[model samples]
Target: MVFSNNDEGLINKKLPKELLLRIFSFLDIVTLCRCAQISKAWNILALDGSNWQRIDLFNFQTDVEGRVVENISKRCGGFLRKLSLRGCIGVGDSSLKTFAQNCRNIEHLNLNGCTKITDSTCYSLSRFCSKLKHLDLTSCVSITNSSLKGISEGCRHLEYLNLSWCDQITKDGVEALVRGCRGLRALLLRGCTQLEDEALKHIQNYCHELVSLNLQSCSRVTDDGVVQLCRGCPRLQALCLSGCGSLTDASLTALALNCPRLQILEAARCSHLTDAGFTLLARNCHDLEKMDLEECILITDRTLTQLSIHCPKLQALVSQLLVVDLPLRDERCPATLPHYRRNLLSGRVSSIILGFRGLLVGLTWEVENLRVTVFVFGCEPNTGTQVLTQIHGQPVE
Candidate 1:
């Protein structure tokens, strides 16, 4: 068949330089570099500073010295907007400093899993990337309160900050961050066990614009701290308290009452939480889109059903509560069963199902008549009973 003019143009060898460069942007650095060697035009566009805005040198092996980063930054010129060096074991403080100095326009920087990065590197980043708005230092073990001081002093425009698993950061560092970066909207301190009530209190006091806060694994934070946070940041859309062992039902209840705009809440591993906490969430926070109650032993079908009824927008849920125990009257029961099944099939659900035998052993008056069996499965197509199964005397698959 004869091709139309448009089709001919598509198959034409000659293409506009801008279009070719735009296409090159989608290619990986290695592939782009290889294409650059094919022709002069490709080389010009590939090496152009405009196309080098986001540099992902993750896992790129090089010498421990600053030569690799320095060379890359120098070659990319000053147009680098985002620099992600995650899992780059070869890079140290010297290399990071070199990049920071050259890429002053960088807005998003991820040094996650970079264990070699010390406070000195973070300090250098604050000094160099004054315009940086997003910084992810997750798993950067060397960063301390001193680094926060530097970050607060320099990166005042920061909007998003993730220091998850940074064990060194204490209340002092968090306070400094809150005091310095008033514009910060999202803060993830998951696994920062050293963080306490004082740090969250500072966030509530200074970071009024905060939209998302994650304090998962921060065992030191108590109900008082969460109460303070909910009372202060009313506009908060997302709040994560997974593994925060000290948090009780009262804190969640207060949060539900206070944070009406809360869209996402993750209270996984919060052993202190009970049905009362979920009831509070159901009564309020109707806009919730995501909730995680994994390992919350106190949560039953009753709370899950209540959450489904209240939070129609809920799209994600991670919980240990059995679907079979939830009252069928709950509108969310059908939806939740499917979600649970999907998570189970995908291996995303981390909590183990406590056997009926274990429950029977734990209960004082439980007899043979008590039917308790937990089946982990994704929701079947068009069938709401994704979590249902018949237990017989003999084991059957």
Candidate 2:
């Protein structure tokens, strides 16, 4: 046990190179690449082909609003495996084509919000990157259905696809895509308004491996489409229908009953949703972790309380009712009620209440079952001075 400092240094040098490479995997692509500039030995290790299996160019902060693809291509040529360029708005069609041509080995590619990309870029990507398994084109507004045909022909191994907000794509494009990419595990089409029930029907017939589907803001999709999707994709683990106005309780009920493994649901703006829909959700989808029902006016306190009781793992719940409410009271109410209400008022509530009416008579009332504080205001008389009153209710406002 009398090891010297020199012996310890020699033992450290004897460490396996595979162990050093494993440690490099945890470091971000930028930091790992930066290590290359430290010393010759570090540069050789960092620039090794195996070390470039997953490359993220999103860290290029200099001139962030400008194209960085050329710099990326020059720095990590032909070695990228997983590339994510989310929010890189400066990347145009040419830059994307260049990146695709060079990084043909990429398996996971996320280009979300890269607005400058168009249909031609997809064609270029298809021509080069044939090994792509995961592709996220969310919010790429300029991309059209023609790109789907190219992607289907090029990337045969694509397993996960996200085309959310690509409004230019219609049922024809989606049908072609589903038919071509049979192994797709996750498909996200949120905000794709042009996609109707026909697309889901096609998907049901084809992509059986789909485990997650996000149809948020797809206004044209009705319960009929979701029924078909649930019946086909039996292993679906998560579904997001936030802002899908056409979906009713029937669709959600069917999904809850059939898709037993469904865990996360986002039905934030489904205006037609009622307590019955939520009840079905609580009973069937017992493993649900997060649910967003923010603007669903029909969601009373009963539904929320039931959700809390049944879904014990529920971590985040967003509801507009939990924020603020307004209450109107009669002028004949006793002054004693106002004293109790005044004590409950907060500075944020006072500012909003003052803008409504000049005066208000405080009163307490129950809406559903949750407690809420309300503000009351009234217009002024001949003197042009308004009156104000604040009220707190034991139930939801």
| Cα lDDT, all candidates | 0.75, 0.72
Q: How many residue pairs clash in each candidate?
A: 2, 8
Q: Residue by residue across 137-185, what tens digits does model 1's lDDT show?
A: 9998888999999999999999999999999999999889889999999
Q: Mind giving the per-residue lDDT tens digits that candidate 2 earns over 1-397?
A: 6645456454335777787777776777778769888666567677666676676556663344434676565556677778778888888888877777777877888888888889988998899999999999999999888999899889879999999989988999998888788899888998889989999999999988888888888888899999998899888888888888877889878887788777778887888888888888787876776677767777665675566557656555555443232332333434644444433332222112122124332322333432334433343232232224333444222
TM-score of model number 1: 0.78
Global local distance difference test of model 1? 0.75
Screening candidate 1 with a backbone cut-off below 3 angstroms (N, C-alpha, C), the clashing residue pairs are 341-377, 341-378
Which model scores highest in lDDT? 1
Error of 1 at 115 (Å): 1.1
